[model samples]
Target: MNRVVRAAATVILLAILVPLLVLSSAAVGPAPRHWSGVSLSGWELPLVDARPRQEPGTVRAPHLDAVTDRLIARGDGGWQAVVPLHDGSVYVETTRLDPSLFAELGRDFGGDRVSVVYAPLAPQVSPDGGGGVPAQTLWQRTDPLVTWATLMFGFPWQLGAALLLTAVAYVVAARARRRRAAGTAAVPAG
Candidate 1:
């Protein structure tokens, strides 16, 4: 094969393989466990009541056993939660807490009752909860698949820059080719 064809083929192959590698690696570990009908203590209120939309909330275990950072979201008529573990792993869960449910529960019970389904992503750091290493924020630790997708599809600026560079290169090449042809035509036949 020609050099350009070989280079293009290599680029295409890498583009396909890179995402597959990232996704498959993300699925390597044990699946995350799910819990249902998790009861919330009134003291746990600080943990669950705060809205993830505004900012992250902090929760210390009722017995002061451990500290956890929590993020809660209630939008699109649904609810979601994210908690990062000490080992740089993350737990993501979602619940369907519609407005009607809230109205039925009223203000008192609304914050106490919930059903959660959670999964643990790969740990980015070792499991050393006792170590002095500070806990990582939700932003620092995220699922690999989510990270990969964001890098692949979310940045419009990168695509725009690439297109601009390609256009400039094409124009420069065209001008060079024209100059070469004109020079050759002006010379007398040997």
Candidate 2:
């Protein structure tokens, strides 16, 4: 499309996507308190099953081997992972807690109403990753925001990157046009 068309489309699309951005960001980041981390150094002992300080809903998703996978699947359903990070910390990350479990907290869809449960698996460190924390996922909470962001805003943010690039292109074109006009005005017909 032409410059004006592309620019107009960019504005319209971004406007439509604003709320979506808020949602997905909420999904992956901090909106949900579902992700719980423990001090890896302090709990130096071997761990058994997930020792959840908090309890999640009965319905839960399966555990993925990696954080990235867990994050991607979080919104569809709750999940748990014990990531032993390189920083000597065992990050027990879990998501998609059933809101019903914490009804007193708020409604299932309410911003403050979700929960994730987790506990350290002893001997948290994988035998091989010697020095660094093995990146274990103890537990995580589901924030409406994270859930929304993951489910909604995620795709927009991905598109946002492309939209941003187009915007830059428009700006560059505008500048180039201005320079060309200025050059024309300065040149007396040779």
Candidate 3:
């Protein structure tokens, strides 16, 4: 078989195997879990309870527990919960963020409530907690496949890439050394 053909076949085989291995490894370990998105508007925020009875409601910054009161800034970046309170409703609004949390807001629910959007809350806060929770907030469900793929293939891919680079470097170095030795041998010995 030609060298190119062998290399191509190997690459194709690994490409298929890599994901399979990652998924298998992930399945064996405890899965990484992600929560749904939180609804917030300036000073007000809303949340959904996933227990049997289901607890949902809108909470404001001043009214929420300082320790558990957390919220995400809207404009850029991601959905980050800065601080989680011991037990209470807290909300935070952001302008610039690092990681995106839009999908999170769309997933993770326990009961009748699949998820809650800004059902009542507009960009601005309202006297009735429109921009926040409605005192009947309910969280939704998350995609387990995505959660697994993130941890499984993500770290493995990083490590695999690093190993591949190191292997290439060794090959190049060996070829260089061989060429240098051949050139030296071609010259007359001093």
Candidate 4:
């Protein structure tokens, strides 16, 4: 390939590969095993609770050994519960629900019940939760093919590519040696 062409290709490849590997690595991990459910309650601050439409609620998990209470904040689309764990506090967001289900929860349950799933073994993204968990575990999110490819290849396409390049180089060197020997033999031992 031309020098400029090769460099451009390399840059483009790096751009795509870097993001893909990052996202894939981030995605690769087993989901949390334990989940806790809490109910949202009215806040003590009158202004906080009575923000017209914004009803800031507090979720208390007295049942959970790890957490006693959490201040659930109202987000744009959902609620974020800042639950304190053994390590630190984690912001758990409520998963999206059906429109009817949401409305029913709002009407009947006052949209109090919120399910927060978490992995005890895995690290959390919260600033207080130290850091995120490494993507070492094979049992991860869906897309078996992608996971398999990522495992087989490697980050930035290094490992498998190195092996392939080595094999190709060896083959080329062997062919050159054979050609040199054949030429020597044709010269009648001169």
Task: Show where candidate 1 strays beyond 4 Å.
Answer: 1-149
The candidate, 1 or 3, that scores higher on TM-score is: 1
Best by TM-score: 1
* Tens-digit per-residue lDDT, 1-190, candidate 3: 6768856865655555544443333334321121223322222134532111113443333433322222322332112233222233332332221113423333322212221211222133323334553332222122334423432344444337545755686599779989999999999977
Tens-digit lDDT string for candidate 4 (1-190)? 6758856865556545543443333234322111112211112122222111222453444433222132212211222233433322232333221233233333432323322321212322333342443333323322344433432333333344444655576589779989999998889654
**Candidate lDDT values, in order:** 0.34, 0.38, 0.35, 0.34
**Residue ranges of candidate 4 with Cα displaced over 4 Å:** 30-190
lDDT of 1 by residue, 80-140 (tens): 3344433333233422222232333233222223322212232333223325445554444
Q: How displaced is residue 95 in candidate 4, in Å?
A: 15
lDDT of 1 at 63: 17
User: What is the TM-score of each predicted model, taking all chains together?
Assistant: 0.30, 0.27, 0.25, 0.24
Off by over 4 Å in 3: 30-153, 157-190
- lDDT for each residue of candidate 2 in 74-148, tens digit (9 for 90 to 100): 332233444333322223333433323223223322222122332223223322233533343444234544434
TM-score computed on alpha carbons, candidate 1: 0.30
Q: How much is the lDDT of residue 190 in candidate 1?
A: 96
Highest lDDT: which candidate? 2
Report residue 73 deviation for candidate 4 (angstroms): 14
Order of models, best lDDT first = 2, 3, 1, 4
